[model samples]
Target: MADQDTDPRLRWLKPLVIGLSVVFVALIMALIVGLITGVPQRRAEAAKQTAKPVPANLSPAFAEQVLNLPRNSRVADVFASGERIIVRVRLADGTERLFALHSQTLQPIGQLTIQVEK
Candidate 1:
């Protein structure tokens, strides 16, 4: 008599447990897939932010400043990377000079002279 009373409850409990387990497994799989797909997208966004050049911080008067080079020097080539501009010059004495400047303000950052090793 008691066994017959509990039989209906057991019948409902088994299906309920199976349904809950399937839901739990589905949620876990979705979480794993989201993490796998989202990581590369986040890394690409971070790389784009870092690769962008920083804004120039200088007064308007600094913009008009001149970059002096040797007399008769001619610009051989120009290359730019990020916020820097590099000007390769052929000097009067047949040597090469590389001048690095800030791209936004055109302010001289530094210079490098290229000479053949003896």
Candidate 2:
């Protein structure tokens, strides 16, 4: 009689091996997806935290002043020096004005028009 152990039909072994292999592959895929998804989320949260507030040293009074202007009235631009700050303010009249301020006091240093854009 032929030996039963040597016969090819070990029916349970094949299905169990296949099931284990599929589970292993699925686990590996899930791990890869979690790692890729986590990185940008962490970076974006860190960026949002850093972007929340400007440092008080840059211009405390100027920052406060600009907050009260009409939402449309904005800093057209800014130029800075060791002792002074040059800011361009766009008025609601659709006109632009330039003001140079003492950086330390946020006080006016000089005022001049650079250009007017209609």
lDDT (tens digit, per residue) of candidate 2 on 1-118: 3345655676677679999999999999999998899989999999998774545865556555432244576688899987778888887777776788776658666666545655
Q: Per-residue lDDT for 1-118 in model 1, tens only?
A: 6557786748778678999999999999999999999999999999998785544555446647787989999999999997799999999888999999987678899999998776
TM-score of each model, in listed order: 0.49, 0.34
Clashing pairs in 1: none
Model 2 off-target regions past 4 Å?
1-72, 113-118
lDDT against the true structure, each candidate: 0.87, 0.73
With candidate 2 superimposed using the best TM-score fit, by how many Å does residue 43's alpha carbon deviate from the native? 35
* Lowest lDDT block of 10, candidate 1: 52-61
